[model samples]
Target chain A: MNMVVCIKQVPDSAQIRVHPVTNTIMRQGVPTIINPYDLHALEAAMALRDRLGGTVTVLTMGPPMAATALRKALGHGADRGILLSDRFFAGADTLATSYALTSAIQKIGESRPVDIVFTGKQTIDGDTAQVGPGIARRMGLNQLTYVSAIPTIDQEAGEITVHRRAEGGVQVLKTKLPCLITMLEATNVLRRGSLPDMLRAERAEVETWNAEAAGVEDIGKCGMKGSPTKVSKVFAPSPRAEKAKMVEGDTAEAKARVAIDALAETDPQLLSVIARQPALAS
Target chain B: KSKELPEHLKAYKNVWVFVELEHGRVHPVSWELLTEGRKLAAALNVDLAGVVLGPSGEGTDSAVAEAFHYGADRVYLVEDPLLENYRTDPFTKAMTDLVNTHKPEVLLLGASTLGRDLAGAVATTLATGLTADCTELAIDPNRNMAATRPTFGGSLLCTIMTQQARPQMATVRPRVMAMGEPDRSRSGEVVRERLDMVEEDIVTKVLDFIPDADSNQAQLAFADIVVAGGLGLQKPENIKLVKDLAAVLGAEYGCSRPLIQKGWMTADRQIGQTGKTIRPRLYIAAGISGAIQHRVGSEGADQILAINIDPNAPIFDFAHHGIVGDALEILPALTEAFRQRLAVDRLAG
Candidate 1:
């Protein structure tokens, strides 16, 4: 039961600061971390490997510096690490991103067929949740997204049952192996790597693959050229001219009443909604 | 199919908003889009059109009439019972067919669960660019659709443009746009279009429409005053602090999307990108880190007072007021303060 988890290096959103002059995010000094959601997916993969007695390979696509993120993955108990880095892969949108990743996964599969591939439901930056499905489509693998729990995996039988979060409720679905699973957050807690694991991760040699090396031939469809969507512009939300009408109430109680009155004046339904809740009011 | 400028659709000249209807009732986001569409139309100096696809019935006709009141200059009514329940395949076909026949410069759809799903498929089918979860939209001087949304989780904003694409498309989150004033006297021309597409060709089936539970309905989109919490609350149980404050102020309660991801609360109570957009009068953000994703969702609030231990938190950058304090201590203090003030006000009144 060999599992491969694909993770991304994302700027610590908490530490990101906007450049006041250029109106661009200041990315120079911000330290990158494994996308918070991908951590859960990595943990899920590692836990499965631990339980089923198999190898876990961590894969990432980014600049050369992204090796740091892969090392972090290795420190978390992955048996192997692979970095898919190339200038051609830069500025790739979800479509091209999935293409490059799927190509690398195929090259990896040449050595040992990957039983499962794991990714977060979406990246914090892209927030599209489309890459996982895109990869599944490109590789002809079963796509399971918004997965909350993996109940069982029958390796020989090539079957897996998972609890998938649908629009309104959970759908307990079953699918064959060799599938891509995007785990929802909080599905599993991440484990801290031991000192020995950190030492090994620090010393381990990570394999890097360029576009041609990863078996990608169509350079046009491999990066920005393959991406159909383009971002034209981004700007700050315009501020409204009118300031908030602060109530005249002096005390907290007075302010509360004023707030309630103001809210009721605007929409009485708000009061009804609150009154309906017993715990809300004394 | 991927080629440019179908001879038939060359003359369509305006922006259109697809008014999504469910259970014979129009979604409120449609009206909201009308207000937004009206602005873009004026900017482009073109007519704003509402394209409603459904069966020919009173509901459909009423929606057309309602569209005029909301500022649409004309309504394109596609009458077909097959369109009653939203199946992605049929809806996409119906919409694309209309676009191909009557070329609109821009298309706006609500970024609802259904809208996102349909927009992606339709944009791919048309091979046109589409932006999702747009918090703002404007027709540039060049007549391109400029869709603005937060990037990197709302730490910064980015505006996306679909260059050289006909029928430029964008999906806006619910409540991010204001609803237009209803004018009962206003009327618009309604052109009924024929839907030749059949239901059998559709691949997905509408198993059921599980309406939201009464208790679970936060109505955050319609909330006037929202008090939301975030991971800063430390413990999931501290969410009750926000609930208590909301209870006193007669406001709805919501949390940042991380709280939902953390399983601290259900999706209904979550507020942010991928959660809910709220335009409340007074928003009390307790312990919220104000990530760009969450900021985009709540930035529309009229008054935002951020309470967090870290004054330097991003929440304060946009917050109208800020208090560097522990939310746990501040929440109870604020709640008790509100309780007493409100009691005194009721007596005075």
Candidate 2:
């Protein structure tokens, strides 16, 4: 029943802005937090552990400062935190990231077998949602993604049933144990840490693993070398030239009337279409 | 300039688009990819093909025929009952098997829920690189595909290339590409492949599918008119104003990502890059600031009317019409105005 939750530290996107004149990213002074979607994954893992009486291990691959994110996870009820950090692991894309994380998970499984692996559906910064499936494929585990709910888990039978979000509907899927799951966001509320959990979080030592210690067999596959995808250029989106034709009025009511008139005038059929829907007109 | 094609990947040829068919309906994004894939295939001097995997039925056959109509020179078909429900195991295996058997130089898929899930697994199984949610796709001098997508929270765009990977893969979000007009006279060869795996080998089973009830879900993608609210609405209750306006016009109502993240609206009602790409005839965005992510989704609207208190809001830059006032106040007024206008027209008619 042991679960491993992978989280990442990302810059608070709300605070991230582009320079007006230079059009360069203004990243300075922004604080880093565990990816918002990962919080839902962490909460899902903790809930399962709380109900099943097992351990939840928080894992992350980032710089040394990323230990803070792991500590935050510990405070939020993760039993242990592991940080996979090394200079060789820098500039890794989702492929290389999954390689390093999968190796670290294998090393963790050497002590206690991992029954399930949890990750967010996608990171706000990367937004790829590829790494989790990459790890699952490499590790030969079932990949369950966009999971909205875990309604039942049968440890004895080695099965888990989940509600997955599809294009037009929800799919109730049942899979075997040892599956990797990427949780959809806002499925459950994150729980607050108790006094004892915070105290323990402060005292707990975060395990830091280098590439070799994490059993990375190939150094070339650990970072940029292993990444097949390369970014050729980064640029800001070009803005459109046409500005909105603003409707002026002293009051909101007048403005509304002007806007409606403008829309109807611009597209004469709009009024007729609205009137045609009798249920809407009344 | 682009790096030379690696010696091992030199044999890879043709461009393939995964034709996503479910419940006997082909997802529009699949056809859109075929349109774009035709250009890429022409640029590379290779054939454009469509890959259809579904149960043995008329659905799969029609998909193959439609692929030809939409500019595909050939169609790859793998029909099996196991491929029906889109389990990750069977779909990934089928796709990876196809790629290994018939090496495609470039593969395109829709950035839908099913496509994203399947692409990730298939790419990983094949140990190839994949670019997700690509906004642009092109072939360079070296014949390598360049996939450009939004990065860093849509504040910037990054062009990614899978330089060393064979069968370079990318997923384009729906509505990002133009759908090609189907030519009924067009025809193509269908190559049928068999999925070796059986039902027992696939660990995951689709226990049930609960289709979204008509009343409970917002059909934003096909709506002719849409009214969306944002954080500028100030409170959850203010959303009633947006619903009222939409009701008057017989339009769908949606909201920006923040409202969905804040639990004020359902995910289906979210209009943005990560949510839904809507191409409504008229879109009224109240209180939205038009971030690049949101713009990518709603820019296809024929007319965009932005309402916000800030004249400097980014939404104004792209909106066809705008009003500088609080949406909280203006939305109710607009609702009343539209209601009266429609009522008078109804009476006259």
DockQ of each: 0.19, 0.63
Give all candidate RMSDs, comma-separated: 6.0, 2.8
State how far residue B97 of model 2 sits from its true place (Å): 1.2
Model 2 DockQ (Cα-based) = 0.63
Error of 2 at A98 (Å): 1.0
Q: After superposition, how far is residue A42 of candidate 2 from its true place, in Å?
A: 1.4
Residue-pair clashes per prediction, in order, are: 16, 0
User: TM-score for all predictions?
Assistant: 0.74, 0.93
Model 1 chain A: ten consecutive residues of lowest lDDT: A239-248
Model 1 C-alpha lDDT per residue in residues B1-349, reported as the tens digit of each score: 2435455445657989989776677888889999999999999889999989888788888888898999999998888988876655567678888888778888998866556556655665565667767777887665667888666766556777765456788887778899978999999888877878775654334443445455556777777678889888989888888988887777888898778878887778888776778888678888888776787778888767777778578777777666666778778877886667556655655
TM-score of 1: 0.74
lDDT of 1 by residue, A1-282 (tens): 878899999887644665678766578977789988899999999888888888888889999999999999889878888899998998786667878998989988998899989988777776666567567656766666677888888888888887765444455656678888888887888999988998999999999999988999688866667665676554455544543344444444454445445655765454444443444544
